[model samples]
Target: MMQLSVAIGDYDRNRPLIDGRAKIDGVDPIVMTLTPEEMFFRAMRHEAFDICELSLSSHTLRTARGDAPYIAVPAFVSRAFRHTGIIVRADSGITEPSQLKGRRVGIPEWQLTANVWIRALLQDEYGVAPQDIQWVRGGLEEAGRVEKVKLDLPDGVRIEEIGATDTLRDMLADGRIDAFMGPRAPTTFVPSNKGLRWLFADPTAEAMAYYEKTKIFPIMHVIGIRKALAEQHPWLPMAVYKAFAQSKAIALEHLSETSATKITLPFVEEQLRRAISLMGRDFWPYGVGPNRHVLEYFTASHHRQSLSARMVAIEELFHPSTLETYVI
Candidate 1:
């Protein structure tokens, strides 16, 4: 059996595979549990793992430039609605997305998947074009952060930088910036801070409404295999895909054991029921066919947002071997 190094998050779905409860056929995976930031950075910059959780935006950026180091399988490991991603200063008096016009918004990276979705929704849903606001790029909690992938945005998109030591939380808390948009919320979003709130008053409701309208859950991450390894071992992508799919299935099955809450938070069963009622039994699905609408919407937004050099076809995003699966 070949040993492959893998880097991914410590989510429940991935836990089973990491703990040997699940197995990839014909291969042994040496898994490393890391934060998304560390995983994406290493994967995007160094191709540091045999398989890793890749930022969808960053992956698309590289693929468009024709230098992608990894070949992806359609196992979406991370996804979120992103309505909650837009964090505004309470004192900014920004009541709606429309009010974002002429404001300065801070972001961690232009190549962030959450920002791509947030930016697209702002323009399409509320007419808040990307060029209308001044974009400030910096770290969310520290300093000296740069875009994960280089941006070649078209004209009219004005982006600037923060001070060497400045963070998005500090700028927004003190009102230096009108709002901050990224995958993670600023630490200032607390009762004591009283400075930040999501742009949407009820982000959950807004997300559900958007889902009902567009049927998109907003994919944030994809599993990527080293391109060289994939080319050499043609069966590897599907093997990895099936292992993740099986692990996710196990996690989902665990969600329905209502005798005791499987998760730390309360209302696990209740929320699960609500999600199933709204999104069907297979709400969080994997693979190309199940998530084509989401991929199409995201690819269109990515190109329109100018994060990609060209419009990335869904067909160009995944391994051909994993594109179609045999049905038994």
Candidate 2:
């Protein structure tokens, strides 16, 4: 069996594989549970892992440049609607998305998947273009954050980088930045901090409505295998895909047990039912065909945002072997 080092986030859907309950057919995976920050930086900068959960935006950018180091498998390890990521100062007067024009907004990185989705939605749904805001880039809570990959921003889109002493949380708290957006809420967004609030008062409703119209949950991360390993062992991608699918299945099956909740959340059953009612049984799908629209939209957004030179097709991103599966 080929020994492969894999870097991925620790989530319930991937827990089975991480704990050795679900096994890949022909490979021995040395799973290293790492935060997305560490994993992405290492993978993109150093080719540190044989397999990794890569940011969809960065991966798409690399694919467009024809220099991607990893072949993606259609296993979407992370997906979320990014409406909740946008946080604004209560006094900013940014009650609506349209109000954000010419205002200062801070983000952890320009190429972050969450930021990419948020920017896309702002333009597509509200007609607020990227050039409309002065973007401030820096860490959310800590200091010394930088974009994992170099960016080629479009003209008229101004981006300012914060020094190592600055953070988005402080900037927002001190009224230095008008708003902030990222995957996680900043430390200053708690109830005690009356200064900050979500840009959308009720982000869940906004997200649901957006999903109803666009049918995109916004895929964040894709499972990637080193290109050399994938080329040397063509079957490796399928094996990884099957294992991740099985792991997700196991997690879903456990989540379906309503007698006692598997998760700590009180409304797991209601949330599960709501998800099914809204999207369908396989709402968090893992294959290419089921997710073509999402992939297309994201890649198009990547190109439009100037992160990619051209829009990368869905077929160009994922390994062909994992695109189709037997329906026995």
Scored by lDDT, the top model is 2
Give lDDT tens digits, candidate 2, residues 1-328: 8888989899999999999998998888899999999999999989899999999988988888888989899999899999989999999999999999999999999999999899999999999999999999999889999888889998789899998799988999999999998998886678988888999999999999999998998999999999999999898999999999999999999999899999888999999999999999998998998898888888888899999998788889999998899986
TM-score each candidate. 0.98, 0.98
Query: What is the Cα-based lDDT of residue 118 in candidate 1?
Result: 88
Off by over 4 Å in 1: none
Minimum summed lDDT over a 10-residue window in model 1 is located at 187-196
Write the residue-wise lDDT of candidate 1 on 31-119 in tens digits.
99999999988998889999999999888889988999998999998999888888888889998999999999999988788888988
Give lDDT per model, in order: 0.90, 0.92
TM-score of 2: 0.98
- Judged by whole-model lDDT over C-alpha atoms, candidate 1 comes out at 0.90
